[model samples]
Target: MSSEEEGCFVNILSRNISNIVDALLHGPENAFDEARKEGLLEREDLDRITNKESNGDKIRACLDIIEGKGNEKRICEKCGQEAAKRCVTCGILCCDQHLKRHQQEGHNLMDPGVKIEKLRCTVHGDLFKFYCMDDWSLICPKCKDGQHKEHEVVPMGTAPNKLKVVLAEKHCRVLKSIESNESQLHEVQEEEGQTQNAGRGAEDLLEKRRKELCQIVNETVDLMKGQINKRKMEKLSLLGKQKEKLEQQNESLHQEKSSLQTALQEELDTASFLQGSKDLLKRLETMSDFKSVERTPLPVLDFSKEEKNLDGLITLNKNFLEKIEKGPVEHPEKVELDQNNLRRLYGRSPSLDPNSAHRQIKISGDLRTATLTRTGNQYPEHPDRFDVHPQVVSCDCFSSGRHYWEVDVRSSRWWKIGICLNSMGRKGGKSGLGANPESWCLSKLNNEFSAYHNKQRTSLSVPGDHERFGFFLDCEAGELTCFGDSRVLHVFRGNFMDPVKPAIGVWDYYCDSVHFVHLVKQTFITN
Candidate 1:
């Protein structure tokens, strides 16, 4: 063969090497031996191919050896052995071992030459030029026109690049999802920090209020001590003057008695003794006739009421502190109001009933202020009077409709302001404000505030001190709300079965007085 034909033959074998190796591994076992005898495969190459455990490994070994040898040879179609002669009639190659079989089949033979061809489609004998995406297979033009007509076919060169583009798009989507997750995590962390900051702000406000209340209490204590000391000194000075007058009268009496005794002991005549006795006896009689010094009662101070007040104050303070330490209550409801609107629409000024006042509770001339007094007023004994508790009720009563009122409570350290049924007990302890089912009240004992109803006391969250308190009663709605300086302190809900009257209680002497604020009519212009 010419050099050009030899080169063409080598190229065809290289392209069909996989098919050739596959056929050799499945066919005659002497193919490798034949290649080695032709000096195309070394002894080591034969050993490697023989040592492979699987047909696939042996095929790969044989292809490698064939690729390196570049031998110009043909494989017999019948038994996969190296071809030495060609069958002229069939245009197929045959080895010497298969030569007699072919001749007996009446086929003529010639020495083998370059007769290998390129791989072609088995069905149509056409070269493969396209890739079928549907079945991931290579197809020739004839195959594409036949069974692969409906498949997505593309040229062999662009199939891999299209798949790469799809993968890149999916990778971009994955990265976006990861970014979204990170953003959500950051939002959650920021919310947690904001919640912490809100808690800290509340804590700071509570601490500031606590300090203010403490200072108020300390100042009140100092004032009370000063007043008590002043009263004590005045009482002591009066008693001291009376004591000095009594001592002087006793000394004068002793001197007169000694003068009479000396006159009798000298053994003088009866005339002389009588003479001395006359003056001494006259002086003694004058002294005895002198009016006896009026005995002054000792100064006495009673603190039983104050002690009780302190006990109650201490209990209230303890409850308030415990509630504060536990943190703020959840869903705290605060009712906001326009002070002027409430005052103009529903404000009332109920006068205190002098007939219902306790003996120790003094009522001002205007009957709007109630004061705790040391001495009982000489009020006529009346059935409506509170015989046990130091409490008083308003003369005005309400059975329905809304009413609002304000009280000046700054003067009192311990006081109660509320409403009670007109028919409630007035002669026993149960008649006290908020002590029985007939009454409800908001009380302040020192720095602590609380709401009481039906003998149940609820600690309130109103911090510091408030000088004025407001009350709103909606009898038809069965609601009573208390406010400290316009801020809602507590609310009481109940069934108002009877007429209720405004009431006040002051049991401590230090609690000077509480006044009811009366609002007058006024007009205003709004823009």
Candidate 2:
């Protein structure tokens, strides 16, 4: 088409499209008037175009232009006539005359929704024909057999579908892992909050206990001061009475002396002077005949008693403070009961085994106590008997459930008492309780208390004077606790492999004695 003719056709086509859009937006009557006013078409041209015959013609022209056809001077590629259609696929203008011929020539019609691009392979200079699964690389037929012959190959379109499924599964797994981690993180955060709250509660409780103890100490001091003051006031009142009587006697003596001097200085006749002298002499004799007042010493207010009481109070306060400083004590989570009740419920009497006793140990006739003897017995040679150190094991053995026992090591300056596995070494040099792996024991040497296990000595801050020791064992949980004077001394935890028996031992060098309190089956009558 000529440039000038094409421009004019394009203008008319655009104007025709604008008129149709305006008619759709605003009614046809308004659009016709707007077209005339805007001079897109003159009044005469607008009237002609709006006529039935020409109206449809401009609309048809607009549709042809939309399809890249119907230029005023455009000629068909096949026929030298005005174009009526455009071959979308071939990008050529066509007339109705050759449309059937063009379709018969095997040119496909264009679909606006479908897009086709020619993608080339950089290496083979061919289209991407196959997908290699092993290398995840695009391959042509030539490269497929050369470098990727061993790889699993698929058609380009199918490869993407297969990868989508795999990618979906991997994405799902990643999301699942994230969810699991998030759940764990949430649990950890919750536990952290609980722990912090528990710590705060414990701090508050301790602070309250501290204040209570301080108040108690202050009250005790105030009471002692009151008592001291009371005694001081009583002593002072008694001393004041004695002082008053002494002062009255002193004043009486002075008044008597003044009367005698005044009579001697007065001028009088011999008879008068003699009478006065006699009177004065009688008064002097009466006044000089004074008996000494018995000197009563002031009562002394001794604070020694109060001081002793304060010392006891201070000692109690110190012990309480020490307990606070050591943090909370671990008590068995059981029903609240008195020691006797607890013993009645869980306690079992375990006597010293005759076979397990060392020669230097003497088992009591009742089989309830074992004492360190000065002389070794003529015991039969036994594998379990202690050859070097004095020791004895109980006859009763426990494998499961909770068990309780008590031992009295009051007389022992050096002793060990605890539970040991029945299979613990009996004759080896390292067979001593707590010296081998088979035993856990508490020991007291002189004033020092300590725990012993596997040849390790763990010092325990416990009193050595605790005469009675209680042992609680939870075999199922593999826990053992030692209580000294009813206070938890130490708790030992381990997976016990064999049945354990209560064992007590004393050093041969120190002939100290230890007694076991045997529990008897009796009905505890509660009143």
Model 1 over residues 1-527: C-alpha lDDT tens digits? 43333333434445566566766677625654554554544578668777898887887676565434435556665665677765544556677887887667744344565322222366775545565656556567888989999998875445444433433443344344335434443443444344333323323333344444454433333333343444444444544555556556545644544564464345642222322344444454455343445442332433332333332332334444443334222211432365675675467888999999998898999999999988889999999999998889998777655677888888888899999988788997788898899899988886788899988999998877888888888766788888886777888998753578889998675448988888652211000
Top-lDDT candidate index: 1
- Model 2: per-residue Cα lDDT over 134-179, one tens digit each: 6656667788888888889876545545544543443344344435
* RMSD, candidate 1, Å: 44.9
Cα misplacement distance, residue 383 of candidate 2 (Å): 2.1
**lDDT of predicted model 1:** 0.62
